[model samples]
Target: MSAIRPAAVVVLAAGEGTRMKSATPKVLHEICGRSLVGHVLAAAGELEPENLVVVVGHAREQVTAHLAEAAPGVRTAVQAEQNGTGHAVRMALEELGGVVEGTVVVVCGDTPLLTGETLARLAAAHGGDGNAVTVLTAEVPDATGYGRIVRDDATGAVTGIVEHKDATDAQRAIREINSGVFAFDGRLLADALGKVRTDNSQGEEYLTDVLGILREAGHRVGACVAADHREIAGINNRVQLAEARRILNDRLLTAAMLAGVTVVDPATTFVDVTVSFEQDAVVHPGTQLLGDTHLAEGAEVGPNSRLKDTRVGAGARVDNTVADGADIGPRASVGPYAYLRPGARLGVKSKVGTFVEIKNTSVGEGTKVPHLSYVGDATIGEYTNIGAASVFVNYDGEHKHHTTVGSHCKTGADNMFVAPVTVGDGAYTAAGSVITRDVPSGSLAVARGQQRNIEGWVARKRPGSAAAKAAEAASRESDGEG
Candidate 1:
């Protein structure tokens, strides 16, 4: 195969998205766990554009920040005002410096369903026909709110793109609509953009105007209709966002199930763009896996759990837990109500009981952390037992510290360890102990306030004592004289 031409991609994301009624940038709004711009950029990345320029305006900083983190090395151009599409392209052109040659693909950032294959096909058609402009078109039942493509009857070439507001009655009936995506010869696009005028009904320069300019200049302008119209749907509000998300989620979910992953309820289980599951991995209803989470073979997740940036090894079971950036080894079981924060790792066959919170800790194989405990910044060795309400008190007012409990160690209920402390191998901590110092290997540590009892204390403290009796007698004598 010949080398793919070095094409430049310009993503138009300058709209204020006023209809979305959100302070966040429109393109930054997430669909299926990724921002809309992210999906668009990923599609563009597949084509390996020589230079990717994203045009930003409203909430430019937010858009730039998100793209920078998600897609490093993507170039950005700013449109300072709410100008029309043609003006947005002009802003990006200024950032291009020298004249651009070869094919250039322009896509809307909000069309998350447009696949890389569709873009590649558009480019291939544009190059194959030697056309100056190839407009990506789609035929929809209702073309309202879209530009209609007008073609010459004899040559079957694109004559012009007429906006809905400016189209005549006959033109408005055209089934073929402009997809707002295009592949253009770079030099011709730059020259034609200058010739477009703001004399249309909207009093704004429409990028569609360039089709007329190119045709009038005696250049071949063509149109390639997309096989699927839904791919070009643009999101302008929350309802549309939902529609786009549904489309994206359906595609991802179908692919996962076909790959042998078991989704008990695909409708209720939400998976992000980067989540993957191996064969025989079961995801129950109400499970949400977000941000690069992976489940190995034979792992069972949820009956209503949320996992983020975590990994589950083979045969692991995680139920009703909220886990973030944690690792669970094979055969380990976690939660009906547990939280595993960043850096928490459960070893093979270990169990994290209900209502427990573990953060920045590592539990060794066969270790069991029973109900109602908080384990933070600690290390527990193999076969250890941590009783109910046992807390590794890792924080002092000024600083945080670590606690280490060695292999075969047993901790009783309601025990507190003030770190930096160590309970050595085979050691034991008695119930109700407040440990502040290290305990040597094979030793038992029990620190608690001594219990004391006082008998007959209530009787001795009664008010009817000698002093009270005298006062009562004086009062009786005074009342009798009165």
Candidate 2:
């Protein structure tokens, strides 16, 4: 944690991103489970500012509603009109009670790649150099549309900023462009913003004008070049959004890898910011770990799995599965095409095999629900075996009911346990049985109808059919043997 704390942070999110062509506000567009503005607020919040206010204009209600949830307790200033950056900051200062002291940081909300460390460094640079205003500058290869940072030849101090539309030929050649991010002396900024005029070609009050106003007032104006240009990159349209998303995801995956999590194929794996992995956790290709999911140490998940808000315990293995709001215990095995829905849980050493669907159910320690089973609203005790093609019939047209299989039970293949039924400990169910009533401990329940045969039925019903012909041939062979 850096010791530098800003007096306030004004985030400008008032621009109407027409290029994005989205019904949703540009700042509200999400990347890795967080809105673009939310990412900015998180970085700005790290500065521990005394006052943090966001200026919202385009899609104000939606952005404000999102802010309420994303950063509760952080204030917002509404810019009723889509004006320039100068007006946005003025609105934020007004919402901050019209007076602020100490260093104030101003940033754009669409730059989700900006980090807390960079903001802290900027604030520290402003305070340490005793400058009235310090603009964040980047040297980009193409500076066609950005404001050019003008520096004095004698002392290399920032003299002013010239917007691209208003720059001279020589100024346009300058590669050092303004990032539109700044750290300023609070009192100086509040006074300088008052003198800013809408005299530019765009007929809007450019925030860059404040730099010249402060410079002419005999206050020192400086510039801090960002270490990386991408950190200050802004998102305007879908293309830039995708680029930023890729960069941020790469950063997250790299950090996770450095922290002892093994991402087998980082290019194909996607992880949310809220997801966490313990040391030694391994994630396979084509896996998406999303929304507060956690992987314990030694857990291995999928070549093609997507888990949301789920927990996989140590030593558990999940392959080719989709699980949401589920829990798998240590040493448990799930999937080769399983679906674990909300409230599904597998105890230690339990197994859920291919084509199994578990919902609102629990499999106890050492139990197995293997292949082609749909188990819902049920619980199976320790050491029990739920055979292939089994169904826990939970829905009854009006309500969903529960089923229970006690410890050490052996359930046979093709079994249907109707809801509101139970099988006691050590009990067994015969194959092809439909169990409806409770079975006593150590007993065998055979609920299917008795077998019966009707001889020559196929021959009488269809004399020339394939079944009848085969029956006639078998009868001739039997007669010859007799």
Candidate 3:
């Protein structure tokens, strides 16, 4: 297959997005586990641009660091002050240090919903029509915040883009608005940008003015109206951020559902692009699968569970749990309120019952920690039974120690293993025991005090107690009967 020819891409990420009311750079805000600029970068990368330059200003350091990590090898240009889109584009052209040849695509950083397919279409339309500039446009019910597209009524040629504040009544009523995305003939972008002026009402160099310059220079200006208006939506505040999140999530979930994964409630299930579900896997409502989580076939998670960087093998079931950096083997059962921390590993058919918390531990196949247990820094052999309310005392203020239980062992309720300790195969520990020493194979360990009988102890403790009153009443009744 032939490689796609590279085009120049200039992304404007220099605005502070002041209305977003955040300390962080607006383009750094995230939705669907990806920052807004990250989404734009992903789209731009699809084009295989020859020269990729991101214009950075407000919180430039943060944005630069993020770009270094998320999208490496892409160059950055500094827009020293908050001017306007035209000025930002001019900075990008200067950073090229040479001519921007074939084509140039200009995009806003805060449009996370923009897809590579739409960008490809825009570029194709511009190059095909031999247009000097192609303005990506959208038709919406309300065009209040967008620039109005002014067209020559009879010839149907794009005359100019009038900002809302500068538009007259007739122009303001135009439903078709400029989406702030544009494709320009590379040779014309630099010349047209230079001719753009800041004489408008806002006294800012509007890139919209570039379209007028190209038109007056006897160049053909075109428009590519996007099919989905939301594709060109720009987020300026939290409300718009939330709307974009909903749209992006719906798209992700729809794709997952079509791929044979079963989602019980699409509305409440939040899955990152990094999450994968094999066929027959079920994800219930209120589940968040984040940070590279994977569920094998037939694995079920949810009813309010949250997992990050965890793996659930086939046929495993996790309910109402919170797990991070853990692994559950096939057919294993976890939760109803369990918490599994980093390094927790459960073998096949094993059970981590209700109200249990485990960390840095491995429970062998067929083992069961029934309920109300805290196990950390431990290892258990197969077929072991850990009774309810049992604990592995792994910490002694300064450092943590290990506990090991061998195969076929039965640990009684309310037992505490004071580490570092070991229990051999087939060993049994009595209820309410606290074991500090190791138990040999096939042995029984009892470490609690024995019970004692003390008759009349309650009578001695309380002279006028209920027993004394009952005894006197019974004697009086017997005498009366006699």
Candidate 4:
């Protein structure tokens, strides 16, 4: 058995996709948290290509910068003119120092859904058949703007490719269209690129012309029908860009669903590629789980929530909550409308309830910081009840201080714990109180002034009152009856 030769990948991203109607470069458009060009580079990286080159022309600076970040060490070439695919690939070939020996897999950067499996298969077919050029073709429902494949009826050898605008009536009716992706023998491809002519209607050098040139020169040319045509779909305009995003999201959602996660509404949910969900994890509508997020088993995530860089423990429920960089323990329940900021940690079975915001704080197990509170730069012990509308007044205009509430404490509604303050274990605070100093353990803390009531002074003070007028009228009416 002979060893399969090495391969290099050439990504064509030189053209400015003006049809996309956006200021941003087309290939830089994002899908599933990655740019279209980045996805293509990722696919090529999977095959471990010996040399990877990207041809950039329009918005070269932007494209080059993106490729540098996304795929470091990959080569780049510039196509000065608005030439066709053949010219772009040729420019990429020129950037290489020596002749490429094995194969050159040409890919379009606008195709985000193109996978490494298909590229490997294309390269394999080219090597196994000992062919000079192998074109990836698909049968589309409408071949209107695509190039149609022309094959010999007897041998099924690809004879040539005819563009839709230039094809005859019979050729235009053919269903199989060229995908603009190919695997070519390195030397034969280089030789054929030189012979491709700019004599077509567009007067641009079409890469499809290379196949016919190789065939006429007595080198074999073959075609491989792609398993899924959607993988080869290209993004040209805004509509197609949106379609690509939809397809990529669908792919991610499908994978997540198949991995034992229950997505209540796939249409409304947006899960990033880096997010992971364990079995029995349930995701509700309008939820977006982004960067570095992980949901443990039996975790229920909301009717409307956004979580990023957060680890949710098993059997936890987050409803209508928004959190980032937070760690939530098992059986924790958060929000009908809560916002948890970075460094927020909730212990097991703890509750961060409606209209609450917790930042850089930690709540102990079984504690309930339920509705309408702001807890920041503080720590609460287990089994404590943080009354509704209570606040940890950590900021005092000069500096921020800490509030510590010991275990088994019960705070009153609307209480303000002015910081540098501590509420001892088993302590209780009166409603509407503001505590500025520490309270002793097992004590009842009350800071409000005592209330007093004054009565029977209204008649003299307000003789013109409606009550006085009504009483006087009643007395006159009784006297007249007597």
Top model number, lDDT: 2
TM-score of each: 0.91, 0.95, 0.91, 0.86
Off by over 4 Å in 3: 1-4, 462-482
Which ten residues in a row are the worst by lDDT in model 1?
1-10
Better of 1 and 2 by lDDT: 2
How far residue 192's Cα lies from its native spot in candidate 3, in Å, is 1.9
lDDT of 2 by residue, 166-258 (tens): 999999999999998999898888899899999789888788899999889899998888998899999999999999988988899999999
Candidate 4 lDDT, 1-482, residue by residue in tens: 11343468999998899998888999999877788998898887877888999999999999999888878899998999978898998898899854577888899999999988788788788889988999999998888888999999999889999999999999999999999899899988888888889998989989899988888899999988899999899999989988888888888889989999999999999877679889999999999998889999999999899999999999999999999999998999999999999989999999999999999898999999999999999989999999999989999898989999999999999999999899999999999999998999899999998997665355566687988776667777989953
Poorest stretch of ten by lDDT in candidate 4:
1-10
- The prediction achieving the highest TM-score against the true structure is 2
Per-residue accuracy of model 3 over 1-482 as CA lDDT, tens digit each:
11334468899999999999999899999998899999998887888888889999999999999999998898999999978999999999889964588889999999999998888888888888989999999999899979999989999889999999999999999999999999898878888888888888878889999999999889999999999999999999999999999899889888888988899999998877678788889999999988879999999999999999999999999999999999999999999999999999999999999999999999999999989999999999999999899999999999999999998999999999999999999999999999899999999999999899887566577779898777667767989953
Full-model lDDT, candidate 1: 0.90
Query: Where does candidate 1 clash, by residue pair?
Result: none
lDDT of 2: 0.92
Error of 1 at 292 (Å): 1.6
C-alpha lDDT (0 to 100) for residue 61 of candidate 2: 88
| Candidate scoring better on lDDT of 2 and 3 | 2
